[model samples]
Target chain A: MDKNINVLIVDDYRTMLRIIRNLLKQLDFNNVDEATDGQEALAKLRAGNFGLVISDWNMAPMTGLDLLKEVRADARLKNLPFIMITAESKTENVVAAKQAGVSNYIVKPFNAETLKEKIEKVMVHA
Target chain B: MPDGAQAGPDEDRIEAAVRAVLVSMSGDLTAKEAALLAELEALGRTIARAKAEIAQLSVDDITGAHIPSATDELDAIVDHTAQATNEILDACETLEKLEAEVPPAAAEALQGAVTRIYEACSFQDITGQRISKVVSALKAIESRVEAAVANASGRPAPAPAAAAPVAPKTEGQELANGPQLPGGGTSQEEIDRLLASFD
Candidate 1:
């Protein structure tokens, strides 16, 4: 619920990035940044003082799940709150994301309230 | 196919029979086809298994190979843009409301921000055209795949699922819509229950 906490939003689709950024603004999240994919997201996360990562599940070069795995593997980023955004809520996908240590997940086309709730859940034990 | 829908099965059968006979008597055969008709019938039977496997695949799968699920992605893109258009409009309204409450300078800034947000909605035209392009590409593949299917099945290929007369899409279709509107995907409760069951 800390509006000041820096968030890194990553998606290959510009529209999705804009949509999520706008949604985050509605949620009163001012400290937000974006990247086009996991590779760039990882680089930004490494360079910045981000407290959370909200990423789309699919992308080229590297996927959000790959970013989650890499984040979990990196000693410095292992505990950062990661909220995965998936285009499908398949059982296997949920299990895979959960197993990879995602803090929470939001199905795409989410609204501000959903973002708020998911961020709250992740923040509780982030 | 729409033009030839009235063509009877007998006509098709006779034509196919003639074509099969001609192909059978052809002097030139590919190395693989020649091997299939070797001294024993086992080779032909062995090749039949592979052909059967391919034949069993759904028409969509055959056509899908040429385009990697672009149809679905394009559909999603179209749907997302429509929804995002409304979402952005709502955002603009919200910013406009905020403008009234803020200081004059901040209000002007808010108005400017709203302009930028509205401009971003221009993604609609480009995205719509992109979706159209995807549809066109899919249509081309559909034509080719249908011909292949016709050759394989020895009948006119039926119209693709997309081109089929519009009907009430099934709940199965709704479920298949990946991360669509709210409640389109598996609920968080399901994931939680799954995790709890594991414990």
Candidate 2:
């Protein structure tokens, strides 16, 4: 059996985290870990190896943007793929995420197909 | 005059005058009463319609889509109605105050107008209150959705692994402070400059 890919899902909402984890599992990424906010996620990142990061934009204490910035700043995790999920569909927000070096941006109310496509795109470039 | 004798023209003229006065008085009273009844009935219908509309509206509609515009329209309508109602009430009060000064015919006409104004104003007030409640409900729904979204996602999601090991802290140092900044006793100005550099 192929070893499962390690995916870290960061979001403030438990439901969204479960949903993302389920989606990743369907995509054959069975090794998924979750964090409640960016700060905790960063701590976990420092502790373990993760192949990809899926994060929500709006969160308390440390936002997804802050997490992305931190990840990009770290030499070890700089090359790791990152995907941002958010409710805000505005062009400016998308541009900002892209400029911050996000692999892809997914808007909220998305289906499994779209999530899969985004993941594929990020993995291909990575 | 004998008990069975026919009434003379003078007596008939006196009777006609009395009948005319009574008919005019009765007509005025009936018109006033009817106007009041009509106004009350209209007010009741308006309230009922407003209530029905309020019942049909979903909370999501108020908060999720075009909320500000909907609220603004509702506020405007309510304000217009309130102003109209106040004007009508003021007019009614004015009429009452001038009851002795104005001729009965003119006063009765003014009263009818005031009644109509009151009916219109009451309609607006009922509708406005219902819409305001709807707006409040919508706001509540919005907050709930936000909360649900927050709760569904794990508060702190995991991050990608860092490449290097953090330096070990001294026994007396706080573990929570991840890494010590170089030059232990940094000045406040230097700290501010460092923070500003991040921005």
Candidate 3:
């Protein structure tokens, strides 16, 4: 995995964002940015050069699924690696995210090892 | 009244009797119609009054009082847990920085302990999501009450209070309910298996 790639983490919860950032730091990924919701995330994704997107599913105004759909629809961002981290463990959620073209999915309350593993899986093909 | 008609005392008496009966029947019909209309108006008023009472109860007793308080308390829980989790993370970071100064065996133990603490802090996220689900449920109830009131009263749903919580953005959001309670939902391994099938 490229530890130097610019990663954007989108979550409405500040604590979750901080936790993910720290976990990424532990995995040796120093470049990380954050957006609180999908709208802000989309703006950041469009304005900046982001290699990967790590987003939570539920948010106000716009959701991670909404973000994924937007990314997939955009010509420039369609191929960008995306991972969804959410507390929703339903089968439909996973299928919907997969249909939206997410690269990987992680259930919440995950450890650094799980985060590393998912990142490696997605970035290897990126 | 016809061109050829017998003019007799009996014929004139029968005509007068028929006129009297017809007039009485017409009067009865008009009175009955008026009574029915009045009853319908009263029924409408009663329904409107009932709907107004229900709306008041929903807004004043439930949404205005209990629901907001409950949601606020849940929000506070998330806030407090987050604060505590950050403090724990801070301690762990401090321990990490001090690892070099500690003896090697103790340093190894400390590292393992810190890693566990980091993992344990994730409870805050899970609990926070669960509380959010509850808040969402409460909001749904408030919406239903408003809808019922509007339908009964033949008026538009009243706008929620300025301080009232906002609804989720989409149907998918409600479907994407956060983590399930114990004994429910797919396990992580099962989820992974399901994802593998998609491949």
Q: Which is the leading candidate under lDDT?
A: 3
When sorted by DockQ, best at the front, the candidate numbers are 3, 1, 2
For candidate 2, give the DockQ: 0.02
In order of appearance, the predictions have TM-scores of: 0.54, 0.40, 0.71
User: What are the per-residue Cα lDDT tens digits for candidate 1 across B120-186?
Assistant: 6645534554466568777787777566556545565675566767656332233232343345447
Indicate which candidate wins on TM-score. Answer: 3
* Two-way lDDT contest, 1 vs 2, winner: 1
Q: Which ten residues in a row have the lowest lDDT in candidate 2 chain B?
A: B171-180
Docking class of 2: incorrect
Model 1 off-target regions past 4 Å? B1-185, B195-199
Query: lDDT per residue, candidate 2, A22-108, as tens digits?
Result: 456546688999998889999999899988899877665777877888899999999889988655344445556666777777655
Of candidate 3 chain A, the 10-residue stretch with the lowest lDDT total is: A107-116
Give the per-residue lDDT of model 1 (tens digit) for A23-115.
677567978899998899999988988999999776656778878889999999999999987565777777777888888877644445567
| Each prediction's whole-model lDDT (CA) | 0.69, 0.60, 0.79
True lDDT of residue B148, candidate 1: 52
